[model samples]
Target: MISGLGALDALSGPQRFGGATGPLAAAQPSVSASDFSSAVAEAANRTIHTLSQAESVSMTALEGGNVQARDVVDAVMSAEQTLQAAISIRDKIVTAYLEVSRMAI
Candidate 1:
């Protein structure tokens, strides 16, 4: 399971032991914006490929007389899962942006 804020802290900053007086420090550099965008794009491409393959599979199943209804259902389910994953990633990106905007700079 995802660890939420704990995971975020681990990724971005140092741990606080008590009443901290400043921003958390980190041992490594933060992820660059270009890297994040590229990663998002790659995920989107995977989703598109999955959706297209699912559609093709469903169509092929329809054309073949021996095709089972379960095959088409599975294709559709796979497409739905890809779409849900893409949406979830997008939501996380948007939420991060909103959080950054809320921070005092």
Candidate 2:
């Protein structure tokens, strides 16, 4: 099984929690995005990149190129997980928007 979600962990590098001990640091984030929109945009971009890479790998394998089965499997699985996580996040955001919309002003 794939160990950790690579895309999320790969985000902006220094933003990742360092070391195997695993608890995130209490220090401020290293991501330079100053607002919610930019942060979400960055994540969306990463999602697209991951999906594109997986698709390319699948295409290469379909053409009987030198691609290995293990590499293709890993790419597809990573793309799948990244997509699933993005969808879940989108659902949560939509749900929150709806809930807030119904609240008393």
Candidate 3:
């Protein structure tokens, strides 16, 4: 259900789009290593939060609470998606690290 651009924005922000306003405009925000690290941390926090929410919902449902089946399904699906995204990012990071390590000094 998520769009490609939405996923990209969620992970890297709007910086990848050049942050331009018009065709002739060329101003872009300066990104530092800390900014990238913060973004990654934020993403991890969000994923953890989502997974926790999904776990709570599932527990509530199992306890015969008032939670609707549809809501539980939605939560599970969202958690699955977040997990998949995190796994994909981890794989990419590992691959990049391995590639960099294999380079000649």
Please report the candidate that would top TM-score against the real structure.
3
* lDDT values, one for every candidate: 0.62, 0.72, 0.73
Q: Residue-wise lDDT of candidate 3 within 1-105, one digit each (tens)?
A: 421113335434356434545543335545556766776777787788888999999999999999999999999988889888888888998999999999999
Order of quality (lDDT):
3, 2, 1
Candidate 1 lDDT, 1-76, residue by residue in tens: 2211122233322322232335453333456666555555666666777788778888888788566788878778
Shift of residue 90 alpha carbon in model 2, Å: 0.0
The lDDT of model 1 is 0.62
Q: Count the backbone clashes (under 3 Å) in each candidate.
A: 0, 0, 0
> For model 3, what is the error of residue 32's alpha carbon versus the real structure, in angstroms, after optimal superposition?
1.9
Off by over 4 Å in 3: 1-30
lDDT of 3: 0.73
Higher-lDDT candidate among 1 and 2? 2
lDDT by residue (tens digit), candidate 2, 42-75: 7788888889999999999999999999999999
- Quote model 3's TM-score: 0.74
Worst 10 residues of 3 by lDDT: 2-11
- With a 3 Å backbone cut-off (N, CA, C), the pairs that clash in candidate 2 are none
What's the TM-score of every candidate structure? 0.63, 0.70, 0.74
- Can you give the lDDT of residue 68 in candidate 3? 100
